[model samples]
Target: MAPTTERASIFDPDALERVRRELRLHPQQLRVVRNAYFKTFASEQETLALFPAPERVHLDPLPLHQRLDSTLDGASKLLFRTSSGLLTEAVVLRPRSGRSSLCVSSQVGCAAACRFCATGTMGIARGLSVPEVLGQVVAAGQLLAREQRRLRNVVFMGMGEPFHNEANVSEAVARLIDPSYFNLSPGKVMVSSVGVTDGMLRFGERFPRVGLALSLHSVRPDVREQLIPLAKRYPLDELRKTVRELNVMQGRPVMLEYLMLAGLTDTDEDLRALLAWTDGLDVHVNLIPYNPIDAAPELVGSSPEVCRVFAAALKEHGRKTTVRRSLGRDIEAACGQLVKAHTLSERRAPRSDTSSA
Candidate 1:
């Protein structure tokens, strides 16, 4: 026989207020001029009425990890695990004062297998559910509120290949952008892909206004393939074509992410290739220094001189480029490094006695 399921209540004042603020609800609608308690109750009901689909309903942030921890009598920590084979576990990082952003996964372990990436070495796991994907954001919000923070953005550059899980990613974006729920402007969100053409095209068609970023580490096909295995299937030429189409469809510039690696993809030749590839396109280059990973001990970040030269070359080609200074590196929160420590620790852990006995 199938297990019985309980219907869960969706009312949450904090989640409702955060949703209201994010959606920019009118003051008159939020005003409580009548019976204070009744007015508050009516406001919440009206908010619920705004979203007919339960999935579209934005509730107070309740992360699965926190709920699990509390319910299990502090027996275990519920880490945010992705369906994407790229990562074994994750923690939803909630910012303290800015708009809320969900750090979403695209793969379990990345098949791109970039030497400098800890997640890349882990191999692909599977894509997360549309609900699970959005759940990370909800969890972040709930945790952030406890720390007096809110979620405002969503990044697909967490642990997986968003393009590999295009369908679910699209669905999550649709639900997030729905006016009845989170109602976030398309411009505020970004979908980062490691140069997946089909997924990029599909995303453009489905949500033309949502922001897009290509995890283009190098313009040279060989270098790209070495860093991102997807490059083998969708080479630079094809990727550029898809990017151009996306720009034309959105009528705005797309973000191009360039991860600078020392003695690897930061050479003058590489800069020239990058410029040539992006020639006459509506796009912005975000130059990111490679985050060191123990998995690939030889991989090192580009020197300041090399990074500056690369950025200068892009500018000389009449392209807009900016250096993305590393944030959260002190806390091991930099790109591609988040999953490394956890993965290493897990591999070293002894097998549970229950399994052996």
Candidate 2:
């Protein structure tokens, strides 16, 4: 009895090329398969049919375990079961603007421990591989294709802190925008970080056209440290400097994600501090309405009126700002509301004897 060999991911260039050589297939056949799976979001059976040796290549590295669609909005949360049996999540957002987006995770769980994020509650499991990260986009794209929509944007705002898994995430981004692969425009991909200065700089240098967003929920050092434990290592000044550098490198505005937490981040002082910090720096401030997470009971989102006023004040100061529309709240797929329930649900289930793949 011989041990079974694992299948190679279809997205892996080296593996796919090796398979192509071994099968003596033409390069065009491989190109067709790749384009079908990536560009057209074709089904696995459909994609594999285009190739002579179906078993030689595998389409999905992380299989879809379950999918939850929002009854309230056009948000679908796809829960993928990793080889270790841990469930990671990706969200497909179909905004009314007609440009669909998929939010992918970099790690199974977050290590940053942001108090306002549900993913931060479950301790870090491990960083997801390049295939695991890209698989999320593939699965979501296929789903959206079924509905006659093409995914236009890929956002790293799901379960994990992307910068913590910078190496794998950057490689995944490289494949995502490669013309031979997903073929997404560099501007369509955005990586959000909790102010990891070094990773942000490296990412900007590598993918100069790709967007970089800083999760600067608060400029106050004490408040930021309280919200994100990682903030202690990278102080507010360092983060501000990093954003300025990224703006220069990318030749575009760095997105500033400011979570509107009631009494915490929505105060007038917070707005003033944000204005001063962002002064002379090219940035587009995206004011996020915090979705309530059970892990952090003390935090609450700012009211709509307050959010409106905050956006107005930023506009008055000649700053670009927008209040991000809250989506997927019903299915727990909104901002800061992913992966916590999945961990809790898995814990309550009975233990199984099945071994991890």
Candidate 3:
């Protein structure tokens, strides 16, 4: 008899087959477990019961480190600890109109180094495995299910830029849309990137129907580079060209994400530059309010009055616009804010405090 191979993640390609061969279970048993665990978010016992080799399987690739719910909004942020002890975040936004969305993270920390974002300050952390990314979805879906709600949308606007971890993000989206797994509609899933031209173009060519958003926080090349250092590599002209190509590839308007900041990107010249950049492209503008991070004290959020004016200016220019309402502000709703705080707190904690809960 040959020695058996050690099992891998249940999300892995041959994980189920190996388990079926080892446990001598019927194919239907494995399918049931996958569907129950991945699709239906069944309980641990219920999912395990569907497998003869339950003990041999790796059910979860991510462990729930902490769960935080916003006292001010219907937003819940989940911090998941990877096997390496590093943490990533996912946010569940339950809006008033009832269509809930999950924001998933793609990396531990970000390499983008956007001046305003907390995660970017942490520097280049490791990319998350596909299982780790998908794990956030599973955990969030289960949490929503318990509240008698369903997750309707998935957005890669959590921690690291989606295009930064292009391969893993692509694979995760594929699994999300696959009927055998999350079964999310392509239109309901949105991938946001900080203007990685090549990655954005490739994604458009592949998942044509899956929505894409360009975080075009500033249209001026210098300001954009100052805010998002990756912008220097991408530049404005090349990025706008890529966006045009994506528009043609998808046969739909792409999302243009503009952060409304007081002095950084919300000025008259900035608005004109944005409109000029968006000219002749099929795009929708999403005006995001600046969520001030202590890491970027130089940045200040635009007032509501200013945001309204900016939206009006874009709409005046015949562009479709939406001002996204801020949620979970009291809970530091900005991506990577809570995780940064928690990571710093843990690092500061005395090693002598070894009492395990």
Model 1: per-residue Cα lDDT over 1-357, one tens digit each: 332232222333445444445555653343331111121222333445544333434433223322222221211122454433223333344333445455666555666675557777765456777656765655454455555554567677777778778788887788667654456678877898888788888888888899999988888888788777767888788988998999888888889999889867888788778878888889999999877777777778898888898898788878999997554455455544545555555558852221110
lDDT of all the models against the reference? 0.63, 0.86, 0.86
**Residue 143 shift from truth in candidate 1, angstroms:** 2.9
Candidate 1's C-alpha runs over 4 A off are: 1-100, 335-340, 343-357
List TM-scores for all candidates, in order: 0.73, 0.94, 0.94
Q: Estimate the TM-score for candidate 1.
A: 0.73
Q: Model 1 Cα RMSD, Å?
A: 9.2
Give the worst 10-residue stretch by lDDT in candidate 1: 33-42
Give the 10-residue window scoring lowest on summed lDDT in candidate 3. Answer: 348-357
Where model 3 places Cα greater than 4 Å from the true spot, the runs are 1-8, 22-24, 350-357
Clashing pairs in 2: none
Candidate 2 lDDT by residue in tens digits, 149-242: 9999999988788888889999999989999999999999999999889999999999999999999999989999999999999998888888
Provide the global lDDT of candidate 1 against the true structure: 0.63
Off by over 4 Å in 2: 1-7, 335-338, 351-357
